[model samples]
Target: MMRNFHRWVGLVLSLVLFVAALSGTALSVVNVLEAGRAIRPASTQTVADLAARVQVAHPGLEQIRRAPSGQVSAWWFDGGQPGSAVVDPATGRDFSSADPDPVRRWFTEVHRSFFLGDSGRIVAASGAFAMLLLAVSGTILAVRRLGGWKRWIARLRGPLAGRLHTEIARVAVVGLVLSAVTALWMSAETFEILSIDEASIGAAPSPSGRTGFPLREMEALRALPASSLRELSFPAADDPQDVYVLKTDRGVGYVDQGSGKLLGWQGLGFWQRVSETVYMLHTAQGAPVLGIFLGAMALGAAVLSATGVLVWLAGWRNRPRIPANAPAARADTVVMVGSENGSTWGFAATLASALRSAGHRVHVAPMSAFHPSRYPHAQRYLILAATYGDGDAPSSAKGFLGRLGELRVPPSAPVAVLGFGDRGFPSFCGYAHDVDAQIRAIGWR
Candidate 1:
């Protein structure tokens, strides 16, 4: 059942995930490059110092913003013309154009929303959600295929596509899960579903009718170190009521232009902090190394999707077609198969054909589809069960034990279990043994 769920979901979202993964990988590379090129501010540098220097360079300085990577940019109105540039906190001078790289922007738009705007964002979020499910379900299947967690890195014996898919998943699942979870959180915040907005800072207090206050002398901005600076907006020249709005890692504050006093302050809200952290994790803005690591993992996601499809196709190609398969209600005997990767289905087909040759009407189905209620004429049940991770049931038999326990009274027909697995594993045929024991306990012969 889990295999089916994992396989179908993967197939449905394969293209979406592939595109996201490629775009995400490109963005990650861009992030790391940007981080490398970014200028790190000195610890001693304070927002006041940076603002003062920028104001000196551009007399009509309007705002200063600091990125998580410590890159600073300043915007100003010089000679009544608006201008902006990447500012060096040390020199407070334009070092680079403030304009975003078009290529990076394109990749970002594609990654975040697939260039579809709001609808694209929803689709991206859905892909993230699907990726998460695939990761979890794939993890379970991988562990089971390997026998157990202790054998997590054990040598795998399977077709190339299946082996490659599992190997890549083992290495990339952690990163994939991280990316998926963070992406979902960011998408939630973007859609206002999670509400990361800062708590209201309340109405701005009446400025002390002050104007032309030196930003260097503003107690609020001066006390704020460059490390914590997010943004600082200067009050408009024509508006006496305007104030210096300072946002920092700690919170947001309003500073009186005339007195340079902090008029109002509000600490960062819990949700806002969570959102920031999620953003960092997802974008790797503040963590470039993680960005690169996640990018490699994202590439793995694409590869996994491709290999997963190949594995599915291979399974279908190799699946043995049963002949004259009898209906469950009319069959004198029922043959249930519990297999991963469709291998056990081959055994079921063989058994069904043998029963038919003996003139016994046989119904063949996956163990998960087991339903004695639909087989009233059944004289016996034949179960071909395979053990999965740590003696757990394989994908096809996921709910078989539960269904068996749900029965108020055991079936009167005799039941036989055939176990399949490698003896190299400790739990070899464990699931089949479990089925046999359960059948005996339930009074089945």
Candidate 2:
């Protein structure tokens, strides 16, 4: 059931999830490159010093914003035209254009909402949720396939697609889960479903009618280091009531343009901090190493999704169609098959045909549907079971062990076990051995 659930969900959400993962990977790469090129300000620099220098360099400076990569940017109005530039915080010297990279912006839009606005956001959120589910379910299934958590990294023997799928999943599922969880949180915050209190400094005090107080003299601004500065908006030109608006990692505050006194302050709420942290984690804005790691995982997700679809299709194609099978109640012999890729079903079909040729009624069914009590006329039971990864029970036999344990009384009919697996694996035919032991424990002949 878990395997089927994982398969069908992957098939349905593969396209959207793939697109999200691919775009996220691209964005993370861009973030890492941008971080590499970003300018790092001196630890001793204060926001007051940086703001004062920027104001002196460009008298029309309107705002100073500090990026997560520690890059400082300035926006100004020169001769009635708006302009922006990356600036050296120590000297307030222009170094680069502030315009965003076009490719990075495009990737950002696609990653966030697929450029579909609100509707796209919903789709993107759904994709994130699907990825979370896939990761969790895939983890459980992998654990089961490996026999137990202890053998999670044991040698795997299977077709290339299945091996690749499991190998990549085992390595990347943690990162994928982190990315998906953070994405979902950010999406909720974006849509205002998480209820983060908007940072506000309340109503600015009517600026003292006085003017000409240097920003460097502002006590509140001077107390903050450049590292904590998020953004600072200068008081409006020629407006006595305008106040310097300061936003920092800790909170938002308004400074009187003339007196340089803090007018009002609002600290970041718990949920607001959580939202910001989630944003940083999801975007990898401040951490290049994490960004690269997540990018690799995203790539793995793409490959895993594709391989998963292929494995499912292969299993479907290999499934055997039994013919002229007798009913369980009337059959003299019962053949139960447990298979992951349907190979054991083929063997069961052959065995059933041979039994029929000898004029014995044979009923062929999955081990999952095993109910010896339902087969009253059966004289013997034949178990054809195939082992999965690391000696784990195959998909079709997942429930057989539990059902077998639930049997109040062992069947009177004699039983034989035929195990199937490649010897290349360390735990060859492990599930079959387990079944045989279980049957013996239940006193089956």
Candidate 3:
């Protein structure tokens, strides 16, 4: 049931994921490049120092902002016209235009909202949710097929699509899950589904009636290291009642321009901090290495989607449909199949058809559905099971061994086992042998 759900959802959402993934990968690369090009401030440099130097360049400086990439930008009014530029923290001068790269902005829009605004965000969030489900379900299915988590890196055997899907999923599942979960959280925050309590610093405190205190001498700004600065807004030139608003990694504060005093402070609330951390994790804004790694994993989503569709189509092509199968209680013969990729089902179908031609009533079903009491009218049982990794039960045979073990007594009918596998495999037909052995051990003829 879960396999079907995973397969269908993946197929439906594959294109959405593919586009989002590629865009995200591009964004990650952009982030890395931006980080490389950014002029980082010296750790010991204070906001006061940067602001003072910038003021020298623009006496009407209105604000300074820092990006997670460590890039700085300054906004100011020159000759009655406002201007903004990326700042050189080393020299506190205009380094470049502050406008974002157009291509990067386009990609960002595509990845974040698909250019659909709120509706696009919802669509993007849905894709994230689908990716999350696929990651989790695929992991469980892979673990089972591989026998256990410890054998996660074990050799794989199957069709090319299946092997490729499993292998890529094994390597990229962690990153994919992390990205999906973070994306969902961010989406929730965006839609206001999550109530992140931001501790308020209250309205900006009334500034001292006097102004013109030197920014470099402002106690709060001087005490703050440039490394922690997020943004610093200078008080208005004409408004003596306005105060300087300082935002940093630690919190927000209001500083009286004339008095140079920290009038009010508000540390980030727990939820607010959590949201920021999640945002960083998802966007990889501050962690370029992680961003690149996650980008590679995202590329897998496109591959996985394509391969998953191929695997599903291949199964449909090869899996023979059973016709005229009888109910377990009315059939004289029962064919129980345990196949991983549905190949064993074809053999079972052939066997059932042959038995029906021989004037016998035969019922076909997966071994996982085996229940001796349900086959009271059965005269014989034929088990067709394919061994999985290291003798583990195939997908359809999962739980059959446990169910068989719980039987207080074997059915009053003869039974036979036919194993299917490559002789090249060491544990070839191992599961079939186990089933036969368990049957005999329980006193079944």
Candidates ranked, most accurate by TM-score first: 2, 3, 1
Predict model 1's lDDT versus the native.
Answer: 0.87
lDDT of each: 0.87, 0.89, 0.88
* Order of candidate numbers by lDDT, starting with the best: 2, 3, 1
Provide the TM-score for each candidate, comma-separated.
0.80, 0.86, 0.82
Worst 10 residues of 2 by lDDT: 201-210
lDDT of 1 at 152: 88
Residues 1-445, model 1: lDDT tens digits: 7778898999999999999999999988988988899996789987888888888888889889988778899999878899999988888889999998898999999999988999999999999999999999999987877776888898765579988998999999999999999999888878988765675587798788768888788887788789898888888878888888889998898999988899999998787788788888888886888988989999999999899899888878766788898888899999998876678888888888888999999999889998789899999999999776457787778789989988878888988899987675677788998998888777767
Q: Please write out the lDDT profile of model 3 over residues 238-312, one tens digit for every residue.
A: 889888889999889898888889999999988889889999988898788988898889888778988988887
The candidate 3 region of ten consecutive residues with least summed lDDT is: 421-430
At residue 298, candidate 2 shows an lDDT of 92
Which stretches in model 3 have alpha-carbon errors above 4 Å? 320-337, 345-383, 388-416, 422-430, 434-445
Native-structure RMSD, model 2: 3.3
What does the lDDT read for residue 437 in candidate 2? Answer: 93
Q: Clash pairs of candidate 2?
A: none
Q: Top model by lDDT, which number?
A: 2
